[model samples]
Structure formats: C-alpha cells, structure tokens
Target chain A: MPRRTCGNRAMIWALRLGLMAGVVLLWEWWAPGGLLPTPGQVWHAGIGLAAEGRLWRAVGDSLSIYVAGMASAALVGIPLGLAMGSFRLFGRVVDVFVFALAATPRVAFIPLIIVLLGLGFQAKTFIVFLGAVMPVVLNTYAGVLAADRDLIEMARSTGAGRGRIWRHVVLPGALPFLATGLRLGATIGLINTVVAELYTAVRGLGGLLAIYGNTFRMAEYFVIVAMLATIGVIVTEAMRAVEAHLSRWREER
Target chain B: MTHIRIEGLGHAFGAVTALDGLDLTVRRGEFLVLLGPSGCGKTTLLRMIAGLLEPKAGRVLVDGHRPEPGHDTAMVFQNYRLIPWKTARQNVEFARPGTDVSGYLEMVGLSRFADAFPGALSGGMRQRVALARALAAEAPILLMDEPFASLDAQTRELMQGELRRLIATRPSTVVFVTHGVDEALALADRIVLMSPRPGRIAEEVRPGPGMREYLWQRLREMVLNDPGSDFYGREG
Candidate 1:
C-alpha cells in the first residue's frame, strides 16, 4: 500500500512538472520577438537579482510589513470576534459596523488611508490589516457562535466557571476556524503588501514588480510575480501544518 | 431524609408546556429514575433539578436550598458531551481541578484510554469518560439524563451493570432520567413513570429487592397506557 501510494504521488509530481514545461515552452515560442520574455530569460534574471542581493532585501522588507499587519489583525480581530459571538447584545451592536467594514472594497480605501497615515510603514501595515482582518473576524465569530451548546451545558453542570468553559470548550472548538482565518488572511495580506509597495513604497517585491514592468523588464517582473505566488503558497502550507497539528483529535467524517 | 424537593414545578417553551405540576421529594442516598416515553419531559424535569433550566412556575430545592450547577450537582448526559479536544484524563480533571483523574478513569474502566480524546473513543467509552468526569466532580447530588441511551444494546447493558455497581459503592442522591423501562428497573430504587406532554407522575413503582420482573410489567403498562400512548397512539 505504501509503495503504491508513493508511486501515485510521484506520478502526480511528474504530471505537474510536465504541464509547467509545456507552458514554459509555449510561452518561449510565443515570446521570441515580442515584448514578453522567455522562461529561460526569466530564470536568469531571477539569478542575477539574487546575486545582486536586491531580491533578498526586497523579500525582507515585504516580509516585515506582512508579519506586522497579520499580527495586528489577529490581535484585534480575534478578541472582537470572540466577544461578539459570546455576547448576543454585543454581537448585535457590533454587527452593523463589522458588516460595513467588510463590505467596503479595501482598494477604495487605500487613497483615504494614505491621506490619513501617509506613505510609511504604518500606511502599508494599515492596508494589509484591512485586507486581512475581515476573514479573521468573521471566521472567529462564526466558530464561537457555532460551539456546541450541549458541551457548554455539560461543563457548567461539572462546576466549570465561565472562564473555564470558554478555555476548555469554546477556544478549542474554534481552532479549525482560526486556522482557516489565518490561511485566508495570509493570502489577502500578501496581496495587500504587494499593492501597498506598488502604489506607494520604494522597496519590496511589489515595488520591484512596478519598476520592472514600467521599464519592460518582463523576465524580472515575472520572477517577482512568481515570488509573490511562492509566499502565498508557503504561508498556506504552514497554516495547514498548524491546523493539522492542533486538530489531530478530530475524527474525520 | 429528603435530599431534593420539587414543588409545583412548571416550565414552558412559548405556548408549548414541557412540564407542569411536578411535585416530588427524593430521599437521601436513593436512586430515583424518571421513566417516560419520548417528549414526556423527563429530561426537562432533570434539567430543572440540575439548575440547567429555570421553572416557569414553582421551585426546586436541594438540601433545603435552590440547587446550582457545578456546585452541589453533577450531570451525565445521554450524548456523553465530552469536550472533543480534550483527552479523557483532561476532561475528568476539568470537572474538578486537583482531583485524582486516573482513579476516576480506573473506576470507569477507562484508565487505559485516559489519554484518548472523545473523537477517538467509541460511544460507550465516551459515556464512561462522562461518568468519570461526573464522579470526579464529587457532587453529592447526581443528575443523569438518559446517559446510556445512545450506546449499542450490548454496551448499554454493560454500562447499566457498571453504573449499578459504581452507585452501590458510593451512595448519592441520584435522579436518573430514561425512557427505557428495563434500564429503570435495573438502576432505580424507585421509578416515577411520567405522562406525556405537560408531564406529571403517572405512577410511582418501587421494585424492592427481587421484584424486577413484576415491576417491569407494571411500569411498562403505565408507560404505554397512561397519557403517553393514549395521546400519541401506541407508539409509546
């Protein structure tokens, strides 16, 4: 069984690589004399940028902003969601505001945010926070609201206090939701980070993309885009690992 | 010797009355079972006694005072309702901090599975954990709401026997609710048969000493004829 599973996995990888090669070959053939650069040229451009240390520096800058924004979102969103879910009156009162913020297009607010916070780390962080916070808040709220009432009643019958019930039952029950929120937040946060740099900042992967595209450095621009995609993939994979570790006790249906 | 007293206890959900005119007194160290068919409000009465619900009218007193959940009462639910994330040991510990959880697990024959989570255990094992947690709570008053109802027949019999033995070792004021006539006969010192809808005591039977068979026949008649089947047609 193990051998067959391994063979299947290898087959999947081979198919994926073959598809990528086919796409790259097609693009290469199509881009010979056009404005678009070939895959080989993109790979070499990536190597050249890496050698110059610009790629690494840009990565570092973008990562810092991304981390900051995500951290702030979690800090703010989780508690808000928990409180909103646990207290009915609180939830009702806050529902309108949360809905308004979530429904508003994040991009439309960028100019306003820039006018208020300026083109600095704070502005970039705010943009990412806006992009990330909605999913985190909504998922956490739903998780808390969706907690098994029977379990809470059982806990109470066992002499557990309100705090103990929340800790033992509500929090652990909400973990799957929390993991989902983090994964989504990571993806959107990365997008916001790139947008922030592209629109306002002088450094980061988004800034590099903007500069390269404007100068018709097609190969380098593709590399930056690939790097952004890689970040999203890495974040999602990491979140999935955390989710699996935390929720190992669940019996899959 | 009365441990629990219910005086004209009544409750309703909107227009549908769940329980009404309940009056009873449970003696200390007695195993009292509330026996009724489905929707007869046996569970509702048990919940009220456990302070999980407030009576729309009347009152319940335990030890001459209003009962409180997690203070003097511990409940075992039909669904087990163990925390899905915590291990059996952790669940028991959460019931009453600073208690010997392993000892409680051992009592329920779950010491081997103490580290297992609820999702990993079979239905019977999860119920055992719930029992252990209830025992660990060290409550003088025990309320059970059809605790073994969801177990398979074989496991249900095993659990019934196990519960009987456990109670024999440590006597408490136990109010067990169940729809199973046999279950009541096996575990109850006194069984209170309830009428359907707006539940009230239809008949109270004491299957003393070697009267299990006779008591079962009598209680089954009451369960089927009195108010339940008459209202719901022989489905009782």
Candidate 2:
C-alpha cells in the first residue's frame, strides 16, 4: 500500500510536468495552423499594451470591480452567516432562503441583473457579488455550528468573559471553513466578472474574446481563453497559499 | 472555610440519572481522586464542581461559595482542550495572556516548543502543555478529568511524575477523576471510589507509604479478575 501511494504521488508530479509541456507544444503547433496565437505574437501584443499602459489599465479595471463585488458579498454574507449560526432563531428563519440561494444557478440571474443594473460596471459587479456570497455564508454557519463544545466550556471555566470565549474558542475553530468558503467564492466571483464582460460587451479579456469570435479570429479567442485559465490558476494558488500558512500555524500548537 | 463541598447534588439527562443525592467534601491542599466505571457520573461530578454544569436539584460550593461560571477554577480535561491554532507557549500564554509567557513555558519544560503547534507534538507533550496551561491559570483549585488516561504506560508514568512535581511546587486543592486504582493510589492523598450507576461514594481508601507496591496486592482482591484499568473506558 505504501509503495503504491508513493507511485501515485510520483505519477501526479509527472502528469503535471507533462501537461505543461504538452500545452506549450500544442500552442506552437496550433498557432501555425491558425487556431492558436504564437508566443512571439502574444509577447509582442503584451509589450505594445504595456507601452500604451493599457495592460495595467485593463488589470486595474477588472480588479476594481472584482474587489468591490467581493467586499460587498463578504460584508453582507459573513455577518448574515454569523447571525444565522450564532442564534437558533436566526438559523431557523433564514436557512431556507440561504439554501434557495445556494441551489440557484447564479448565471441564471444575469439577464435579470442586466435589467436592474443596466449594461454598465454595476451590472458586472452585481453578477460577481451574486456568485460570491453563498459559500461564505454557508461555510461560516457550518463552522460555528461544528465548533467543539468542550473547548467552549474550557474557555468559560477559565474565567473568560462571553466576548473572550467567542474570540478565543469560536472564531479560531471556524477559521478553516471560512477560508474554504472565501477561496471558492473568489473563483466564482472571477468567473462572473468575465462572463458579465462577455455578455455586456465591455473592455475585458472576455470582451476581447467576444470581439475575436465575431471576426473569425480563432487564435485571439484562444489567447483570451489562455489568459482566463491563467487567472483562474493564479487566484486558486493564492488562496491555497493562505490556507497552507494558516494550517501550518494551527498544527504547531 | 471548606475549599469544596457538594450538598444534595442531583443531575439527570432525560430519564437517566447520572448523579443523585451525592454529597461530598474536599479539604484544601489535598489530592483526591474520584474513581468509578464509565457512565458512573465521575466526569459529571467533576464538571459540576468546576462550574461547567448547573445542578438540577442542589448546589456545589467551591471555597465556601456556590460554584460560579468563570470563577478561580482550572480543569485539565481528558481531551487536552489545547487550542489547535496555538503553539505550546501560546496555549499556556492563553491562561495568563497579559503576563510573562516564558516563565510558564519554562516551568512545563516546553520552552523549546514555544512555537510548535499541538498537532506536531505527541500526546504526552500535548498533555504537558495542558498541565502548564492549568498551572498558569493560577487557580487555587484544580480539577482534572482523566488527564493522563489517553497516554501510553511509559508516558503516563512520566506525566504522573511531572504532575507530582507540580503538586509539590504549588499546593492547589485538586479533584482528580480516573478509573485506574493504581493511578488513584499513586498520586492521590485520598481515593474515593463510587458505585456503578447513580454513582455514590462507595469506598474511600488511603494507601500510606510504599503505597504503589502495597495497593497492588490489596486492590487485586477488590477488582474483578485483574481487569484492565482504563480510565476513560478504553482498554489499558
């Protein structure tokens, strides 16, 4: 069993390296076939965009909407989750509504969001927030509910006040779940941002892909697809790093 | 003033009566162990004395007053209740967060693992951290619920030594709970054994000098076929 587990780990590493190599090889092949943009052409485009400062501008615009939408979701969702989790009454009152939100396909609301928010940045932000809120709320509530009863009693027995008990015992216990929710929420938020840009004809990688699709420029569309994939990977990796750091600290005590 | 007293103590969960009409007394600076089988209300009694549970019928008094929430009380739990996020020093520091942290760490011989978290440490090491936390609490009365029960025999012996050393340094009136007769004999000044269900004080045994070697023979006769003495209902 141990040897097989070791072999499995080795296979995973090999597969990851092979996947990276295969993507580069296929990109080179398909670029010539007029379905993929060459590395050279993308680099040239990157440099030109940098010179005009449009690359940074594009990044800033997307991030501004992303951060705003995420913040709004967190402000509303986390507090609601905490309230729902901390009190039996609140949990009973809102559990059905929260479940409804979780089960709803957020993309289904894009058309309704457009009608309300119009084809502007507000519409994009609205969609992003819609995708981001549920995970945070659900995870926070579950984490609070699942915290160990003995730990809470231990804190209380030690002359700790109610506030201190909540801070020391409850908050730390719920952290792992909250971290999980935030990471997943961020990914969903990013997808919604790009989708909103695509549907509304705004200036984003998604919009750029849409323009390319209209002109039969499959290589450019493929380039935007690559960028979106990279963004997803980067965001997920960042969240994973944060989670690892917290776990390392948590495990040591 | 009596340091600990239980009067007409009664508690029940649904139809099951865990503790009933139990009256007890613990003097200051005495090591007393409550020994009983599983589901015998040993832990429930300890928790009530520690002010974790409210009595359904009567009252528990610690230091001449009713056991109150957040009093001068410290319990070294069987589960080691060490915060998972904290380092060894951090866990001890949690007991006295505003004081000098290094002193408690040094006292527990955990100065090296001040930054090491609970998951990285062995069970014995984690229990040591928990002991340090209880000591740092500076409570006059300490309550321990089978704190050494989970450890291996060797580790349990060393922990017993560590606990004895701490008891010598700082004399705190403690109520210790366990199922092991040897453990109750080794560390306790007074060993109070309870009946099976609706636990009551069945017998109180005091083993004098050469206690460990002597009680081994006496307790053998009282026990059922040298049954394995596992404090928390697990096999030793």
Candidate 3:
C-alpha cells in the first residue's frame, strides 16, 4: 500500500511537470505578434515588473488585506460558533440570524460595502469577513451539536464539573468540524478578499487584473490570474494537510 | 452493611406503567442479577439503581443515603457507548481520566488498547472500556445492563471470567441486568426474574453460589417444569 501510494504521487507530479512544459512550449509558439506572449517572454515581463517593485508591491498589497480579513473572521467566527453550539439558549437566540446570514448572497453586498465604507481596504475587508464567517460558524455549531452525549453523561455521572465536561467532551468533538470549516473559510477568504478589492480602486492583484483587462495587457492579466490560482491551490492544499492530521487523530485506523 | 435498597419502587411513563411496586435489597459485596425479557423494566430498574432515572413512586437508598448521580454508584451501559473520538484510555478515563485508569483497564483486560480510539476497536473491546470506566469510578455499587451481549460466545466467556475475578477482588455490591437465563445463572449470587409488561419480580431464585453445575440444573428446571409459574401468563 505504501509503495502504491508513493508511485501514485510520483506519477501525479510527473504529469503536472509534463503539462506545465507542454503549455510553456505552446506559449512560445504564440508570442506578442501572434496576439499572445510566449511563456519565456511573459517570464521576462514578470521579472521586469518585479525589478521595478510593481509586482512585489501588488503581491504585498493583496496579501495584507487577505491576512487581515481572514484573521478578523477567524477571531470572531470561532468564538461565536463555539458559544452558540455549546449552549442551548445562545444557539437558539442566534439561530434565526445565523441562518439568514448564511442564505444571503455575499457578492451582492459588494456594492453596498464599497458605498458605505468608501473606496478603501476597509470595504474590501468587510466583504471578505462576510463571506468567510458563515462556514466557520456553521461547522463549529455542527461540531458542538454532534458531541457524544454518552461521553458527557459519563462525565456527569463521575462528578466532573460542567466546565470540565465542556472542556473534555465538547471541545474535542468540535475540533474535527472546526478544522473542516477553517479549511473552507481560508479558501473563500482569499477569493472574497480579492473580489472585495476589485470593488474599489485598490492597488492589489484584483485591481491590477481589472486595469490590465481593460488595457488589453492579456499577458500580465493571465499571469496575475495564474499566480492567484496557484496561491489558492497551495493554501488550500496546505490547510487540507493540517486538517487531515487533526482529523486522523480522531479517526479509525 | 447494606449497600442499597429499593422500597415500593414504582415508575410509569405517563400512562404505561413500566415498573409497579417493586422491592429489592442489596447487601454489601453481593452480586445480584436481574433477569427478564425485553419490556420487563430491567433497564429502567438498572437506571434507577444507577441514579440515571428517578422512580415516580419509590426511592432508592445507597448506604442509607438516597442514590444520586455523580456519587456512590457507577453504571455500564449495554450498548458499549464509548465515545468515538476518545481513545480507550480516555474513555476509561471518562469517569476519571486522571485517576488510576491503568488499573481499571487491566481489570477488563484492555491495558494494551488504552491509547486506541473507540472507532478502531471491536464491540467487545469498547464494552471493556465501558466496564473499565465503571470500575474506575471507585463507586461502592456497580450496575451493568447486558454489557457483553454484543460480544461473541468466546469473548463473553472470557469477560465472564474477568467479571468473576473482579468480583472476587473488589467485592462491590453489583446489580447486573440480562435477558439470558444462562448468563444470570453464571454471574449472580442471587437472581430475580421479572415478568414482562407492567414488570414485577416474578421469582427470587439463588442457584448455589453461581457454580457451573448448580446453574446448569437451575437452567434445566427453569425451562422444563415451571416456566409459566413465574409469569402466570399475565403479561400483555
């Protein structure tokens, strides 16, 4: 089984490398004169942008908002979910509001956010926060609700305090659900961050892409899009690895 | 000293009476098995003894105090309801994880599976974790509801031997509920049979210190000559 797994991973990597090589070769056949930049030439443009600090600045600008927005969502969403899920009264009180928020189309609020908060990073952060919180909150609630009743009963029967029961039984049960939510939230977090940035004249990848698109700088535009997609994939894969490790601790071997 | 007593124990679920006017006394270090078919209130009685449920019309006294949950008594559920997320050690520690769970796991012969999670365990192994949790409670009374019924015959035998050894060593007052006549014969110091539907004690029979041969003979007599003498065909 171990050998098969290794072979499969190697095959996938080789396939990816081959596809990347093939795509670059095709791009070389279609350059600026052919209405597309060659892969080698785009690499050169990317390097020139980096040397002039425009590319790095755009990258840095995008990352700050992404990290800040996600951190805010995580900070608030997790605690709120844990509180709602672990306690009946709190969960009941917020149940209607949570469901309503979950159903609302987050993208529709982009115009409203930009209007209210103005053409700034704050507006972009607001949109990302709205988008990122639902999964974390919902998953956390599910985790708490799914906690084993027997385990809680056993604790109660053995003179464990209410606090102890929550700590020992409730928290561990919710960890799996929390990990799942956090993984999903992180992905949507970046996407919403970029989408929110596009709502304003923000000097980030989203804005850059918008400008590049209008000016027909297709090469730079595609490169930025590719970079964003690659970043998303890498972040998601890393989070999945962490989630797997956490989930496996509670898994059947 | 007496460990427990149930006086005029009666309970009804709204309209349908599950248990009616039952009385039982458990002496210290005695192992009493309550035997009955399903719907005979065996589980209810066990729950009452464990303080998981309260009698509507009676009281349960343990060591001269009213039985209360989180004190003086611990129970093993038949379903082996081990928490899926918890390891065997953690489940055994469900009652008191920081205490001497190692000793309790050894009592149920699951010391090796301590770090193993419930999801990775067999039905019998998980039940042993339940047994260990109950044992680790250090409660004076132990109530088990058909804890090993899910296990195969061989594992059941092995667990019975373990229970016997545990009884010999700790000597707590035990109330075990089971539907199987042979199981009651093998385990109990004294056996009380309950009739089905509006359950009540039909007969109290002691099968000679729970010896193998004595149980065999009692099993024979229980089936052949007077099975209905106990119930009188009054059940619905």
Candidate 4:
C-alpha cells in the first residue's frame, strides 16, 4: 500500500511538471512581437533583478507588510469574533455592523486610509489589515456558532466552568474554522499588500510591477508577476501547513 | 437513604412544556431507569439531575442540597459527547484533572486505544471513553441519558452488560433514561414509566419475568393514544 501510494505521488508530480512545461512552451510560441515575454526572457529578467538585489528588497518589504497585517488581523479579529460568538447580546448588537462592513468593498477605504495615514508602512499595513480582517472575523464567528452544543453540555455536566469549557471544548472545536479564517486572511492580506504598494507608495513587488509596466519592460513585468505568484503560493502553502497541524486530531491516521 | 429528590419539577422550552409537576426520589446505590417515549422529558429530567439544566417551577436536591454536577453527579450522554480533539485517555482525564485515568480507561476496555481521538473510534468505543470519563469523576450519582441508544443493537446489549458489571463494582446511585424496554429490564433495579409530552410518571415496576412484555404493551398504548407524542410511527 505504501509503495503504491508513493508511485501515485510520483505520477501526480510528473503530470504537474509536464503540464507546466506545455504551458511555457505554448506561451513561448504564441509571443507576438513583444506582446508577451518569452519564458527565457522572463527568467533572464528575474536573474538580473536578483543580481541587483532589488528583488530581495522588494520581497522583504512586501513580506514584512503582509506579516504585520496578518498578525494584527488575527490579534484583533479572532478574539472579537470569539466574543461575538460567546456573548449573545454583544453578537446581536455588533453583527449587523460587522456584516455591513464585510459587505462593503475594502478598496473603497483606500482613499480614506491614504488621507489619514499617508503613503507609509502604517498605511500599507492598515490596508492589508482591512482586507484580511473581515474573513477572519466572519469565519471565526461562524465557527463558534457552529460549535457543538452537545459538547458544551457534556463539559458542563462534567462540572467544567465557563472558562474551562471555552478552553477545552469551544476553542478546540472551532479550530478548523479558525484555520480556514487565517488561510483566507493570509491570501487577502497578500493581495492588499500589492494594492497598497501600487496605490499608496511605489515600493515592494507591486512598485516593481508599476515601474516595469510603465517603462514597457514586458520581461521585467512578467518576472515581478511571477514573483508575486510565487509569494502567494508560499504564503498559502504555509497557511495550509499550519491548518493541518492545528487540525491533526480531525484525521484518523 | 434518599440520594436524590425531585419535587414538583416543571420546565418549558418557550411555549412547549417539557416536564410538569414531576416528583421522584432516588435511593442510594439503586439502579433506577426512566423509561419513556421520545419528547417525554426523560432527557430533560436527566439534565436537570445532572445540574446542566435548572427547573423552572421546582427543585432537585442531592443529599439534601441543590444538585451540582461533578460534585453530586456525572453524566453520560446519548451522543457520547467525547471531545473529538482529545484522546480517549485525555478525555477521561478531563473529568477530574490531575488524576491518573489509566484505570478508568482500562475499566472501559480502551487502554489500547487511549491515544486515539474520538473521531477515530467507533460509536461504541467513543461512548466507552465517555463512560470512562464519567466513571473517573467518581461522583456519587451517575446520570445517563440514553447513553447506548446510538449504538447498534449488538453493541447496545454488550454495553448494557458492561454497564451492569461496572455498576455492580462501583455501587453508585444511578438514574438511567432510555426508551428501550429491553435496556431498562437489563440494567434497572426499578423502572419508572413516563407518559408522553409534559411527562409525568405513569407507572413504576420492578423488572421481573413478564416486565418486558408489560412495559412494551404500556408503551404501545401510550404511543397509540398520544397523537402529539414524537414516538408516533416508531417502534416502542
């Protein structure tokens, strides 16, 4: 069984690599007079940026903002959401406003954020936070609401106090939901980081995209886009790893 | 000695009355079963005894004081209600922290699966963990609300026998609620039959040679006459 699973995994990897190679070859062939950069051109552009140390700086800048924004969102959103779920009166009172804000497009607030915080790291981080927080809050709230009532009653019957019940049953039960929220929050935060860099200040990978696009550096533009995609994959994969760790008990094996 | 006393116990869920003007006394070391059809307030009464629910119109006293869970009683739920994230051993340990739980897990015959989470266990195994947890608490009263009802027939019978053996050794005052007549006959020292909705004590009998048939007939009659009973269209 183990050997069969290993062979299956190898086959899947082979298929993935073949598909990627096919896509790159197609893109190379379809490139029409600078309309798009060839894969080789994009690779060369990426190497040039790396040699100049600009790629590292942009990655560092973007990642720092993403991390800061995500941390803040988790800090504020998780507790608030849990409180909303735990306290009936508080939840009823605040849910309308929360849902309303979540419904509103976060991009609309960029202008107001710029007016208040200006084109700085704070502004960029706040923008990411705004994009990321709603998902975390909403998912956490839903998770708490979905927590099993029977488990709560069982804990109560075992003489667990409110705090103990929250710790042992409620929090652990909602972990899968919390993990989902964090994963969503991380993805949105990365998007908001790019948006912040593009709209607010010309910095990070987003700044590189704007510069390359404006200068008609199609190869460099493609490189930055690829870098952004790579960052996105890394962030999402990291979130997934964390989620799996948190919910290990959910799986039988 | 009276271990538990419920006097004029009445409760309602919004507009729906669950239990009304109910009175009962449980003796120490006695295995008493509350047998009733669905929506007959057996679970409601058990929860009240477990101190997870408060009566709206009356009171429950354990040893001459208000009943408090973990102090007077430990409950085994119909759904098992074992914490899915906790291992069987950890779940048993949770009943009373800082105590060795191996003995309780062993008693339930789950020592080998101690590290397995509730999700990994079968329904019977999960309930065993719940039973272990309740047992570990060492509370003087054990209140079970159809603890084996979710299990298959064979497993239910096995669990009933296991429970009887376990109770024989521990000798705690037990109040078990169930709709199964065979289950009551197998485990209870005395069975209290409950009427349909707004449940009241209909009959009390000591289990003997013809008790199962008698109880089945009574349950059938109740189900037939009580149109509003949730047990309608279901076997007694």
What would the per-residue lDDT of candidate 3 be over residues A28-135, giving only the tens digit for each residue? 775557577677666777777778888788888888888887788889889999999978899999978999988988987778877799878788777778888889
Each predicted complex: what DockQ?
Answer: 0.59, 0.51, 0.46, 0.71
lDDT per residue, candidate 4, A141-233, as tens digits? Answer: 888898899888888888889999988988887888988998999989999999999999899999998999999999999998889888888
How far off is residue B127 in model 3, in Å?
Answer: 2.6
Tally clashing residue pairs in candidate 4: 0
Model 1 segments more than 4 A misplaced: A1-35, B208-236
Task: Estimate, for each residue in A93-189, the C-alpha lDDT of model 1 and write its tens digit.
Answer: 9989998999998999989988999998999999999999999998999889989999999888876788988988888898899889878888899
Candidate number achieving the greatest lDDT relative to the actual structure: 4
Query: Among the candidates, what TM-score does chain A have in each?
Result: 0.90, 0.83, 0.87, 0.93
Off by over 4 Å in 2: A1-18, A27-60, A250-253, B208-236
What lDDT tens digits, residue by residue, belong to model 2 across residues B87-197? 788788777878877877787788898888899898988898998888888888889999988899888988888888988898788899887767787788898877655
- The i-RMS of every model, in angstroms, reads 1.9, 2.6, 2.3, 1.5
Best by DockQ: 4
Model 3's CAPRI class?
Answer: acceptable
The true-versus-predicted C-alpha distance at residue A79 of model 3, in Å, is 1.2
